[model samples]
Target: MIWILSIMMIIGIIIFLDTWRGIQTVLPLSAVEPLANDEKVSVIIAARNEEKSVEMTMLSLLNQTHSELELIVVNDRSTDATGLIINKLARRHERMVPIHIETLPSGWLGKNHALYKGYQVASGSFLLFADADIHFEKDTISKALTYMKAQTVDHVTIAPDLQAKGFWLQAFISYFLYGFSVFKRPWTANHDHSRKGGMGIGAFNLIKRDVYEQIGTHEGIKNRPDDDLKLGQVIKQNGYKQRFLSGVNQLWVEWYPSLKEAIKGLEKNTFAGFNYSLAVTVFAITTILISHFLPIFTLFSTDYAVQLLSAIFLIIFLALYGVTIVKMSSYSLWKLVVYPITTTIFLYSTIRAVALTYIKGGIEWRGTFYSLKELRGKQHQ
Candidate 1:
């Protein structure tokens, strides 16, 4: 019992300190000065069955305050009206270029291959890779360029504001952000001297054309489901300067419409995040059980000493979670009331991802099935 209490305290202290560091280190996109310059930035977006949000996303890019901008929107073999929408927008707007992919090549994911195709024809000095569904403020590109130029960093990835419609979804998103901040330590990515800390957000990843090509571009990480994160890792591994930013009001993405969709959405990357290692997955599950669930269960212990320690651990846990909710998300602190419920759902999601991947021998993403053997073969940072 004494040893368990000590471990809980240690975990609490580490999470608290790390969460504080992340809050302090991540810069707000709104605070940066918006630069209106002549440097052309080619914005690349890969869309598959995103007809609902692609137009709004494209319109947001077209209306950027920065005058010199190009949009390369790729239609990755969508069975729906995504291709038609892109073509219609391209016809009306000369700045927007549309590319249609009829088939995905071997040894590559659909979205990744589509992005690589977009990059091949991009003529800008700076390249910005974004999701098809992400909406941006008018000055988002200008402000991002300002920060990149001011800092002289080779790559910049901004964590966008995750928009959720319901209370439960908000709770789950808040908890996800908290876990990501605490475990990933994203603020460390800003540390110029460390290669261990690197991050990439799919919503907004801006890189110099030369830097992107120098890192072998998407050709190197074609099979990686988490291409955004791997892009940042390769940048860091190759000794390029990288920075992470907060895009609270500047960039927004409704990650999933409901809890069911959210769970389905995470199926592709959750197992891949652990590098498809069963040992690592089991270890992560064990750690989560002890750190998150143990405290709640121990609160009902008959021993007074155990109860006190558990209560202290819960306080620290809530404090870390509250800081993330307040700083990184638009949700109120009241959402912390659902911490236990959300944490359970998160654990379940992780387990489900692992189970389904092994059972199916692969992951189904964007209506395409990628084998685990191929994914593991290309799992190099």
Candidate 2:
């Protein structure tokens, strides 16, 4: 009876997660068409060992159909020749402004510091914070800016096309982005734009200059995951309007190099979100096991009816996963066959993130070792 109750609960929760996924934000996510007068914009590229993608990003930004713009690339003390690449781009394009990071004060996190540094030199009314890995169409930025202006949104962000190159990389990233975003209701991010709200990825975000300072931008969650869902919340909670666009055709970002790279990246902030509390951590783990793994238990049961029901539910989950992938990116329908494999990676990453974030001090990013506790304290800093 107890086992039956658990299975029923899991089924109910899965249904709820899937339904909530439909409640998307009603923002202006029209197709990417060039804005009539969308100029007077600046692009800020933050990099540290991004030599591979920096040049392409510059060329992409330069080719944008917008006029009267400045592209500032801040090389954050990269040991690689990332700076040289930036300088080369600047030399080739008169509008490109390649700036070396002067020095970051002790309190600031690296990306936030680099971004703030870039903002210092920007003279445009609108500012774009794009990752070094992202590539966009000629009209992408202009179209996005026009939509923001038309809707009067202080901040606008589009979910980038998650380009998965490896099998496991495809498995894990698709689950986290498409599956998780669908489940987490990231589209309706503004409703809970506080510490309790969903986060915005810094990659491919366009914001008004005034609103950036009003909410303190990354300053609110600087010590935590600078990329934590806080930026959206900060904008929403502070009374600035914001929206998430589903423009898969217009923008794309390569999240990481390999599955190992992806794991290390998520490890840093898995615990960073939980305030490092023991009780919340335990609850989270238990919830994940129940909601995601309980169906596997159906195999050991003798009841034919229960087994059949569980199988049906699992198949429904696979369909949803496939729908998510195709909607968010250009993955084929046959990829749905790998749902179980993908979901397992998602479960494992969350569990691994919890263990490493709590048992070990904190996961490493670049070279910084920011502890979970240190991150929470730094939020107020």
Winner by TM-score: 1
Worst 10 residues of 1 by lDDT: 372-381
Error of 1 at 17 (Å): 1.0
| TM-scores for the candidates | 0.98, 0.87
Query: In candidate 2, which residue pairs get closer than 3 Å at backbone N, Cα or C atoms, i.e. clash?
Result: 193-233, 199-229
Candidate of highest lDDT: 1
Query: Residue 209's C-alpha lDDT in candidate 1?
Result: 96
lDDT of 1 by residue, 284-351 (tens): 88988888888888889999999999999889989988988887888899989988799899999999
The CA lDDT of each predicted structure is 0.91, 0.71
Distance from true location, Cα of 111 in model 1, Å: 0.6
Give lDDT tens digits, candidate 2, residues 32-60. Answer: 45567734888888898888898887888
Worst 10-residue lDDT window, candidate 2 = 19-28
Error of 2 at 288 (Å): 2.4
